[model samples]
Target: MRNENQGTPRRTNRFWVKVAGVGLIAGLIGGGIAIGIGGAIQHHEAVVSTRVPSGSNRAGGTKVNKNKADLNGEATRAYNSVQGAVVSVINKQNVQQDNGILGMFGPTQGDNSSSSSSNGKLETASEGSGVIYKKSGNAAYIVTNNHVVKGSSALQVIMSNGRKVDAQLVGTDAATDLAVLKINSANVTTVAGFGNSNSITAGQDVLAIGSPMGSEYANTVTKGIVSAKNRTLKAGTDGTLTSVIQTDAAINSGNSGGPLINMAGQVIGINSMKLSSDNQGSSIEGMGFAIPSNEVTRVINQIVKHGRVIRPRLGILYTDLANISAKQRQSVLKLPKNVNQGSVIMDVKPGSAAQKAGLKKYDVITKMAGQQIHGLAQLRDILYAHKIGQRISITYYQGGHVHQTTVKLVP
Candidate 1:
């Protein structure tokens, strides 16, 4: 019985050994398959990596194709085309020298400071930018911001070639903030063409070329996209509204009156002001404004033709309804509750269109030409849309009642 049991244990051990051998063979075969697959993947990757151009490495590596990374793209070309037309405008004003005690005490009441021993000398008052837009006969015309040339006894223009020449103020319009200057065309090599601002769309790429702080940085070009169109912002102390194009291009103090160019290398707008901060003193960025080229063209043409922009005038003094307190609106103006927004006429010129049309003091203008008038800005915008001698309808509230009338616009 002991011999038989020992023989049975030996058979069991043999069976277990056979099973271990099969398991070892299967593990080896599976590992070989995995190794084969990994080798094939590595080979495929190597073949693909070699397919890259001869001098260029894979994307993960540093080397790249120089042919595909050219810097002379549309923005570069556009800047090059208009760079010669950009100029720096210098405003020179007569300044009195401080003659110690004399300056401290001031010029004796009748003493002509101009004739004082310390003669008034012309010095740079401010610096801005301009664009050469036209050349006729021996003179070339430049367009710049009116504020740039304001209060200047003399104006000088620094051309792109670094040549400085005297500029004559041909015309200036304060309402539009535009001025035209005439200079000798001898050195004027380029004149920027005006593009149709009416055709410009939001998100279109644009370039701004100017001398951003002064002439030392002349021909500075900034690239950005149009952020908005037909933006109306309050301008000047009179609360006048100016329509402008908004862009993200970097514009600084000296960039005013510079050309805002499109991809076609044409001037689409004139760089004016940038909002650096809100009323709360918070910093604002990438908010630059430009006068549309269409408005620029219109104002320039009239300035060149008549030395001023002649617009149809209503000849009425008014205040925005929103400026008045709700109590004043209800008690003084007697405006209806629904009459929330409008311009309140304070006075009317005797011979003006408003007077002739029976518009009186305290009349709240609610609409003009069938368009709603939110305030003085909207009223001015709509009024300017019509030409002189054209007749338009006006809607207003008077004596707590709505009224409509047609009146002829006159200069």
Candidate 2:
């Protein structure tokens, strides 16, 4: 029960499997084995609300009829508006066949050979959810979590009506855990709209639409309130800081890349990961997070235009100073007695920003752009905050002496 990212691992015989590791955050990607349902596209109109008139009470106060009141009001409308646009994403990978002597001998009598061994076939590696965001020129674009389609040989999209279509990988940004996909727009009748995530306040109603536990539960909708805004979490293996919207919605395995919609039926966030437990192995609940739609729009635009995200690079590998022993800091790095935290440059890329700035190996970086750099992660977080070609100040200790220099960031 250590801190781990959660993605549903592949299971056989309709069983559910969980992936575990040392991280509290769990990506809602389902890797379970499932059967795809085939059918034609079926369109569903948004539900209309019915109004009931209020009656006068004996005390002269207006009394509304409880029995005739619309219980499925905003939530129902919000869900219906985007339900058709939500889809199930399938990640298929090429199953490797055993090349050993036993595998080459083939299955003997009474032996059950794997279906993937019969031919060079692909198998379902994982499943998640996605939202159809845009349609243009016979192609529809989808947005989902990068982990949902990571290491995939091929990807498929299961529409709301159970229609399956091949999806092309447009681009993926692992730092943000977001990916863009392209599919045929012929059967895509609905396109979810983006809302102003920056303006969404805490306690505002929201809806989450996606497949939970695979295509078998596709188009599932859950209601919740915006628990908090601007919640930051350390994402990816590199510990990149990512800001996301926190909610109490029921985002489960297979809901990754799905849309978190507002009461107005506009997508405010893209469901990504959740905190499943504490570092001490205590189970926690109601702590799901989604990528703010504003960031998603920015990243996807660049991905669609460039097939990749272009970010400023420091062109140097470094280790966190906190990870080094005090003896190593003084003996190997030759740092001052008070200097305990920084990034120790390991290698500088040739003809790159660090090299151009006269930075060398063993330089301990203490500050960047006037901000204190405690470790590599903090340095990276500050570095990524600037744009490419921007000049920034860098402070480091060289030969036990402190010095400051300006370096222009490059892409």
Q: Which candidate number would show the highest TM-score if scored against the true structure?
A: 1
> Cα lDDT for residue 284, model 2?
85
- Give the per-residue lDDT of model 1 (tens digit) for 198-282: 8999999999999999999999999999999878885432456877899999999999999999998999999988999999999
Per-candidate TM equals 0.75, 0.66
Q: What is the per-residue lDDT of model 2 for residues 1-411, given as tens digits with 9 covering 90 to 100?
A: 863434334343225322343122242222121111111111112222333436855587666766977868989988988999999999999887654335566644334544334346999989999999999999999999999999998999999999999999999998889999999999999999999888999999999999999999999999999999978686543466777899999999999999999999999999998888999999989999999898888889889999998989989988888888899888888999998878999999999999888899999999999999865556766787688889999999998999988999889
Clashing pairs for model 1 are none
- TM-score result, candidate 1: 0.75
lDDT minimum window of 10 residues, candidate 2 = 33-42
Residue 63 miss distance in model 1 (angstroms): 11
Please list the C-alpha lDDT of all candidates, in the order they appear.
0.90, 0.86
Error of 2 at 220 (Å): 1.3
Off by over 4 Å in 2: 1-67, 97-118, 196-203, 230-234, 237-241, 317-351, 358-382, 385-387, 392-405
